[model samples]
Target: MSKRDFYEVLGVGRDAGERDIKKAYKRLAMKYHPDRNPGDDTAADKFKEVKTAYEILTDPQKKAAYDQYGHAAFEQGGMGGGGGFGGGADFSDIFGDVFGDIFGGGGRRGGGQHRAQRGADLRYNMELTLEEAVRGCTKEIRVPTLVNCDTCEGSGAKKGSSPTTCGTCHGAGQVQMRQGFFAVQQTCPHCHGRGKIITDPCGKCHGQGRVQETKTLSVKIPAGVDTGDRIRLTGEGEAGEFGAPAGDLYVQVHVQKHAIFERDGNNLYCEVPVSFTMAALGGEVEVPTLDGRVSLKVPTETQTGRMFRMRGKGVKSVRGGAVGDLICKLVVETPVNLSSRQKELLQEFESTLAGSDAKKHKPRSEGFFDGVKKFFDDLTG
Candidate 1:
């Protein structure tokens, strides 16, 4: 039987671009693939026809000869009569070229054998006190991970014996199969793509190259490290397979909450409580800082919520810059557990100041009342 024109089989013009040719071939191949069509002989035949068309069209020399002489180029032995369905061109090759990677066939070459791979990274969460974070400290941590076995030297083979080359792929790690008009390469299933087989496996690790172990690591935390800061330790992670390079370990910092102070960037804020007498008549008081306590002078007639700034009293940033200041907000504390005599004296003092206008001493309260009055007036009107 005479064969159809290659371009006609793929539904592409003779002058179609390479990309267009590939697209047309892919569409037809997918439609008639043996896997998709099952036992449909017609679809399988169409798939072979499509693959042969693509194989010839994609090759510059083959395509030129066919274009000039048609099928006569191969029939007269000009391009080899058995070339279309033999040699590198086959059905397996077509499927591997298109679907092998998706199906886990496109791995490190050598018959699908497993190779030495990098180890997995690890994370260690470290909790830091506010003072420690602001001042910085060196801490020791114990981490459990997989380490290369010293008994077998990470080979996973017994003493005096080592892994042997895979017979299935002959140490190439991959095997080629012809499908339709193309050659497809896939990992060797017998060796699991490792290209090597261990005859005598180590009893300690059961043919695995690593074992569980604990290691101590010292980490230096720079000053001004806030929450969510991470410190990386290279090559401190779990051991890799078959003695591959180790992975990294990350130390994540979590800053503990402070009882007296809150941090905002490099600044520190604290609420300092003062007696009503101190707020009214001003005095010097001790304020706590990360370094030590310092004296802060309260001015006469100081109001509640007044902030006092102490320069260079907060944390120094890890990233080099000017030291931050400590801001203290004053909160007036009412006198509690007053005696009868003290209460009587307070009553007398309250009566003495009663006739005076409260607005002069409580301007904010007076302004709030004025706004309420205007709101009611607007509603009534």
Candidate 2:
């Protein structure tokens, strides 16, 4: 039977890059792997086809020849297709390359020595008040993680003994397995890919080379940091097995809500209530700011919801730029709970505001009622 196109087998376009081809191959290989499919011959055959296509397309020389000749380049004994897939392509290397992230594959160390793995990264979520977030502070945090075992000096062996080479993989940390027509490399089950075994395990850590412990660390928060910001602390994560490098610790920041102020980016917003008399008569009012109380002049006949901007009163960005402004929205407050004498005086004042000058004093109410009357007249007409 004629073979299908390499691009079609991998479900990629002819102009696909190496990264794209590799990604496609990894996905298909995982789906049709013989171990995953068990006794399914169709999936095994598909896996073989995908493996061959990946091997050819990933090689620059082989891809150039195949693009020019279209499978005829490797037919018979042309470019190395005489023996097997891609003319004796190293299938073990391909399997390792595709599944390295999942399996953590590594070659044997120099002089047949075993190499320990690095530690895992960690994240810590921190909550801060708006004031503390805007103006920096230092915090001490305690984290529970794995630290190197002191009894055996992180060697995973008893005090007077050391680790021995694994008999299963012969210190190679990997073993080759053949299933049908394909050969793949996998981690050694006996050594668990460490290439060494502890004859006498450490009693403190039980041969793991690390022990659980809680550590305290101090983190300095920078000024103007907002929510969703992260501060990285290097080498503060779990300790590596044996003597490998430790991982990083990420501190995630979340700012708490404020009572009076709302923040948008670097700007700060707030609502200030003004008495109806103060709003009408134009006077200086004290407004609260992050720095201190400031005097704001209310213009004559100022309406509700009028915005006043105070320059440079907002937060200065941590990333460095111009400081933002503080925006204050005015709200005219209505008086409540009047005394009898005050009520009498207000009623008398209302009588004077009536008559022909009522529209002059309450123009908005007069215009609204006038529109309502005109609407009724039009409906009647």
Candidate 3:
């Protein structure tokens, strides 16, 4: 049978917090516990399911993977195989892993009694002009985050006073509880898994072991970076908890809209307006590019919507490809706001086109009129 969703199994929403998840799991476990259910096999299976769900949801790393990939994250060949809680695994170990402090149980100690929690990662949304994105630039940014407390050197205790071992769990950071035939371990209530209590808290950090402050950092942006690209600044995020490593800072890039140019991959596109005289007679005109103004030769009898490509005049890809071309789409602009002399000159020019070769001179216009005449004839017929 396909497994039910962990959130559904615990009867909680997807956004349920740590405390809510624990409380829900405890309620379900109590109802379906083998000790409470006696000889019911269904209840025992349910208890296993609930335990598996709680184990995955409570651990931040496991929960992140599960949230991203769903059940595939814990499958045998899928993510890491049944989340290391399947058949033949010790139930007591599973019990000890999560509920240790709850049941007043202690595990092996390390160099530091305080927990070494990783710092939170940070992201800075950076907006750059199109030209700046095409070319590399260095910038400085300010970010507000947590840093290690200097008063007690991140120990959280007042100067000259250190933390004492938890009296509840005896430095095990967990406690064991026996309910019927099962034993469960839970976090120590007194020390809350640090296994130590601070008699005097630091005045500077107020026992939080970190302070909030704004930090200035330098970021170098590489050329040809596009939207959604990010530059990683290692160890530039918030300070780690209890002397652990700091997280990474990611500067996400957003390119501002350009006035004249639109980019596609390494290529660039722009519309250049050509006068009717230039389109008909053909002449050299000045066009704008990133490299500055350049002369573009318009061929004789050039039509509107004709595209011209300038080679090696576009963007060089940040991902290392050939330099792209700039394609200019030509739009022939009709003359407007004519004076009386201009109108008389146009009328004289129109009279000159009344010759029989006029049809040959305007083949596209004659062909379109012919097609329209045939359409009306076919409809009447």
Please provide, for model 1 over 1-381, each residue's C-alpha lDDT reduced to its tens digit, 9 standing for 90 to 100: 778999999898988989999889877877887766889989988888888788788889989988998877877456856645324545655666655532234322313445668999999999999999998899999999999988888889987789899897898676777666544567677766677888899889888978999999999999899998899999999989887899999999999999999998889999999998899899999999988889999998899999999999887888879999999999999889999999999998777655457677667777798999999999999
* Model 3 whole-model lDDT (C-alpha atoms): 0.82
The TM-score values for the models, in the order shown, are: 0.72, 0.70, 0.72
lDDT of each residue in 179-206, candidate 2, tens digit only: 5444556678899778888989999999
> What is candidate 2's CA lDDT for residue 41?
78
Off by over 4 Å in 2: 1-115, 177-184, 371-381
Q: Clash totals for all models, in order?
A: 25, 1, 24
What shift in Å separates residue 257 of candidate 1 from its native position after superposition? 0.9
Q: Higher-TM-score candidate among 2 and 3?
A: 3
Which portions of model 1 show Cα errors greater than 4 Å?
A: 1-114
State residue 297's C-alpha deviation in candidate 1, in Å.
1.3
Residue 247 lDDT in model 1?
A: 96
Candidate 3, residues 1-381: lDDT per residue as tens digits? 788988999999999999999989878876776655779989878888898888789999989998999888988776556444345534445544554422233323211244668899999999999899888899899999888898888888998998888898888765666775445565567887778788789999988788999999889999999999989999988888767788889999999999999988888899999998899899988878888988889998898999999998899978988988889999999899999999999999888877787887777888898899999999999
